[model samples]
Target: MNDADLVDNLTALESLLQVTFHDRTLLRRAITHHSCCPDTAVHDSYDTLEFLGDAIISAHVVEYIYRTHPDASEGEMTAVKSEVVSRRVLAQVGQQLGLFPFICVDIANLRTFNERSRDSLCADVLEAIVGAIHIDQGTEVAREFVTRTVFPMIELVSTHAIDTNPKGRLQKVVLQRTGHLPRYRVLEQSGRHNDRVFLVGVFEQEQLIATGKASSIKEAGRLAAREALQLLQKKDKRSSADDTTA
Candidate 1:
């Protein structure tokens, strides 16, 4: 994007975020996607800002949980915090802000092409915004931003005991075992809007591990991840038994 377009995007984003940036350049960097921009000396992309935002999110959310849920157990607190800081929730918040329209990215390599990439990109940009805001305004402003947007999700997480992070869990398993992340592909979608069924297939290095179906794609992906983990567990058990016998 040209300087003029960049300024226009920054203006739109600021309006959406309801904050004025003291460091306009910082705000610009937050929305700059590495896939579409030139690398700088200190950083090539939002990676650095995203890292800072992740830490800031954790610390702020932890403080919120500690203060508000004093009677909660360690496990309860852990669960709630996890949901609040999860990629899914972060991405949801980003989508609500409608930041995709203002993001600077390569047309062909757009994050909107794939569901996974879109969610990840949105979450990353949201985090980058948080990081930029903290740097430009201060921790207080950043905390307020998160408290208004991300903190309320805690209620939904606490109400639902089952976590919808199978993809994340399966990702760890695949990375540890084969040095690759598991992939989720949408196989089929059926039914009406209020009662739709989605079938998602989980693949490890091009081989299909399992397929899952649910009312929502996210739930279906989680089911597929669980199946993949079980398969790995069985394989591990067999290997352990073989070793013992030998």
Candidate 2:
């Protein structure tokens, strides 16, 4: 995209984020997905910025949580941090900011855009934005951005929200109820570098219960586990009803 277009998009993002980067170039870099320009030598992408931003975001969240909840124990702070930094949380934040429309992607591969998952892109863009803000302005400004924009959205999400960490939750629930843990096995993997998709199956005691597909193996596994848990819950309810009838 040209400078004018970049400026306009950044302006829109600023309105959405409620903060403006002093160096608009940083903001431009943040939104430039790798798929938009595979040749790094030709055009900038968000990967490097994402790496830096990830650290900055993590540190800021930890500091904020530590200070805000002084009386809360370390475990509580850890849980809050986990919730805040989760991929699911970041994707939600990105969606709220309408970042998807502004993503720099390959025009030729538009079909892939529709078919593939958007969560990774959204999370990457969110981190890249944080890195851009930190570089364009300063850590304090970036921290403020996190506090005002990101934190509020995360907080508004219900605490009793269904556990997004389905794999862990499923394992715990299974162990508690049946004294057995769920297992995940990769069923298939496809696509080329930077756009691969994984299919995973979740099993309990050699019984294949659920399967899912995603861009990443972990994501696919989690989804499969979630489906398996749901199926198991339904089975349990049916068993209870049969017992009552008898």
Candidate 3:
């Protein structure tokens, strides 16, 4: 984007973020995708800022969880912090803020971007902005921004327990019921390397209980584990009813 357009975007973003930048260039770099932009410097991108922001976000999230959940176990606090600082959650915040429009990038690349790629970019941009805020303003202001945007997720995490590791949960269930651990196997894979999809199956004692499909093997495994847990729960209910009838 040209200087005029960049200024307009920055002004609008400032209104959204509720913080004005003393160094406009910092904000510009935060929103600049590595894709070609005539007015942006070749080296100007969110890469470095995103690295710094990742660390800042993790630290703040850890601190927030530690303070708010005094009685929470260390494992629980770590899980909560992981979910809060996750790329998925950060991308959600960026999408809510309507941040994509302000990002300077090659139009061609933007047009071809897929959902996963777009989300990754949004997450990176969110962190980059935090980094820029830290540099241009100060740690206190940046912390305030994180508190407003990311800390709210703590309640959601607590309510849903979405941070619980699905594989671990399933393994515990399986071990208790059958004295064996659940196993995951890659059933199939498709799509190109950059946009691959995986199908995974969870087995209990050599029996395929459930399957899941996702963009990554790890996610696919989690999905399969969740399905297997539900299947096991249903079976347990049936067995309990049969025993009662007996």
Candidate 4:
């Protein structure tokens, strides 16, 4: 878009964000991908802004989790915090704001913008916008923006929370991948029944995927499931990389 059109679009984005843009240039830069504008070194894209946004959002999220869930265990708080700040979830949040249509990337890079990576682009721009807000309005305004915009996303994500039942998630993933369910077996038990340590192995058909040790069979199973999830995530990344190379 020309500068005039870009300014007009920025005005609309400012309206959407409910923030008055004291400097529209930052917002313009935030929406731009390095491929689109290779004017500056390294930061012509929103990479630096995205980095700043990551830290700012993290700090506010930490405070928000601590204050809002005061009675929650450290594990519980960490689970929620991790999910809220995750790239996937952040992309979902950006999608909810209808940002995909507004993002600016090099025309040449348009071929790479599939539904999956488009969401990633949205996430990056969302963080860049947060960074821009911090620079323009200061920390308090940035905190307020995140608190207002991001807090509701917590509920949206919690409704579909995966950490609540890693075993169930693992089973579903395994079933989809292999058309077979995973089986869990207790490898060993130690100590008294009340204070026992259980070793568990999770297997897909006859092939073992991972093992875990916990205070109970159920907890051990969950730990195994969590490990399986990580393994699956790594596998997915590898698959995606292969596809890109192909």
Residue 139's lDDT within candidate 2 is 82
RMSD of 2: 15.6
Model 2 per-residue lDDT tens digits across residues 1-246: 687877788799888877876777777778887767777713489898888888988898887666544433576567878878888888877877778988786757655644135776888889988888888888888888887757775444313232466676677666776688888899999999999999999887787889989999988987897687667656765776788799
Per-residue lDDT for 62-160 in model 3, tens only?
Answer: 887775554355776777778878889999888888888887767685657788777888899999999999999999999999999878887687435
- At residue 207, give the lDDT of candidate 4: 90
Q: How close is candidate 4 to the true structure, as a TM-score?
A: 0.63
- Among all windows of 10 consecutive residues in model 4, the one with the lowest summed lDDT is 154-163
lDDT of 4 by residue, 216-237 (tens): 8888998898787777656765
lDDT per model vs. reference: 0.80, 0.76, 0.82, 0.82
**Worst 10-residue lDDT window, candidate 3:** 157-166
User: Clash pairs of candidate 4?
Assistant: none
- Residue-pair clashes per candidate: 0, 0, 0, 0
What's the TM-score of every candidate structure? 0.62, 0.58, 0.62, 0.63
Between prediction 2 and prediction 4, the one with superior lDDT is 4
Task: State, as a TM-score between 0 and 1, how close model 1 is to the true structure.
Answer: 0.62
